[model samples]
Target chain A: SQKIEQNSEALNIQEGKTATLTCNYTNYSPAYLQWYRQDPGRGPVFLLLIRENEKEKRKERLKVTFDTTLKQSLFHITASQPADSATYLCALGHRDDKIIFGKGTRLHILP
Target chain B: DTAVSQTPKYLVTQMGNDKSIKCEQNLGHDTMYWYKQDSKKFLKIMFSYNNKELIINETVPNRFSPKSPDKAHLNLHINSLELGDSAVYFCASSQDLRAISYEQYFGPGTRLTVT
Candidate 1:
């Protein structure tokens, strides 16, 4: 069966530290992978997208690495702040319009 | 200005009732989608429409129906709501489906509670 799993249900990181979240999948060759950030009582907001051909993507204090061979993607937040605390979601998409999302990992940036 | 918006941010109703959630996007995107996020926080695509045409329909129940009046609006109607139907419904849109999987902008989401 095809499945997508995040590293954990919750993660705790100190402020100004680096936080790493992992997403792994089985038996799916997705053309692109996406990361989304959702806050409490809010819908998910798009963060980053990495194609299978691309190894890494970055935006400001955020970075994403994609390894199709390993079927895993890593989302990193450097110099994390309290505002960065949110549920991070991993999604896989193919040629078609459908995308499968994994259960999100909630991150807490403790001050 | 809100790019994507859904009506009635919170809805509470009884079982066996019928309800509708309306969504509209002003981003000028041609493709729209409806997603359901359960208590487990797993987001699943229920239906997708591109330019008023149904493009993707997942293994959703027959009680759930999606309507696209035009390219800018997509509405979800659920008949005979049950306890399992209680979840957060989100509406999202992208620029175009032909693109290399563009990012989606989501609405504020509607939280449906069934009693």
Candidate 2:
């Protein structure tokens, strides 16, 4: 069975520092991987998508790296702030339009 | 204006009662999905509809049914809901899953509480 794993433990980082979250998968070769941010009492919002051929993608202060060889993707938030605190999800997209999601990693930015 | 919206943000009902959650998307997308987030906060896909046709149906119980009257609307109906059905249900939409861009927009989510 295919599985997607994100850090189950919450990540706590100081404000102004960079936070790096990881997503690892097995038994699947997804064409692309997507990241989403979910706040308390709210649904997840799309963040970024990185392709199998792409090494890295950036948007504002957010960065995503996909390493198909390792079947892992890394999401980074630079100069993180309290407002950036949320649970981030990673999803793997198959060619058949199937999207499987990880449990998500909760990041807390402490002041 | 909200791109994706769900009705009855909070639903409280007794076990064995039937309920329904409605979803609508105004982004003119061809795909809509239903996802359930459990108490442990694990999100999983339940059903997906494309162009008002059922495309992806996960390993959900037969007690749950999804209806898409139009491409922009997908509604979830739960029959004889159980205590295990207590969770948050989210509706999402995307232009097309197989399109060049596959970003999904999510609704505010409807929290279902079965006591």
Candidate 3:
């Protein structure tokens, strides 16, 4: 079965520092990988999407890198703030209609 | 304006009861989906509909049924809910899943607790 795994433990970072999260998958080759931010009691909000061919994508202070050979994707939040604290999810998608999501990595930016 | 919205933000019911969660999207999207987030916060897709047509149905119990009356609306109804059914259900919509840029917009979610 296809499996997507994000950082299982919560991550704590100092304010204004960079926070890097990891997403690794096995048994599947996804066409695209996406990152989403989900606050408590709220639905996930799309952040970034990177295709298999794309090595890296950036948006403002957020950056995502996809390595199909490594079967891993890295999500980075630079100059993170307290407001940036949330559970970040990694999702994998194929050519089909469905996409699978990871359990998400809880991030806390401490002031 | 809310792009995706769900009715009954929180539902608390007993076992063997039947309940429904309603979802509506005002983004004029063509694809809508239902996902279940369990206690471990693992989000799993249950069903997906494109232009009011069922496209993806995952390995979920037969008690859970999804109904889409139109492209903008998808409702989930669970019959004879069990204790294991307690979780947060989310509704999401995208322009078109078949398209290369398939980023989903999700609703607030409905928390169902089977007591």
Query: What is candidate 2's lDDT per residue for A7-60, written digit by digit as tens?
Result: 666999999999999999999999999999999999999999988889999999
Per-residue lDDT tens digits for candidate 2, residues B6-110, read: 998999999999999999999999999999999888889999998999999999999999999999899999999999999999999998966725899999999
Clashing pairs in 2: none
What's the best-to-worst order under DockQ? Answer: 1, 3, 2
Whole-model lDDT values for every prediction: 0.95, 0.93, 0.95
- Model 1, DockQ value? 0.77
DockQ of all predictions against the true structure, Cα-based: 0.77, 0.67, 0.74
Stretches > 4 Å off in candidate 3:
none
Clashes in model 1: which pairs?
none
For model 2, the superposed segments whose C-alpha errors exceed 4 Å read: none
Worst 10 residues of 1 chain A by lDDT: A91-100
lDDT by residue (B39-100, candidate 3, tens digit) is 99999999999899999999999999999998999999999999999999999999997883
Q: Local error of candidate 1 at A106, Å?
A: 0.5
- Residues B43-115 of candidate 1 have per-residue lDDT tens digits of 9999999899988899999999999999999999999999999999999999887773899999999999999
**Span of 10 residues, lowest total lDDT, candidate 2 chain A:** A92-101
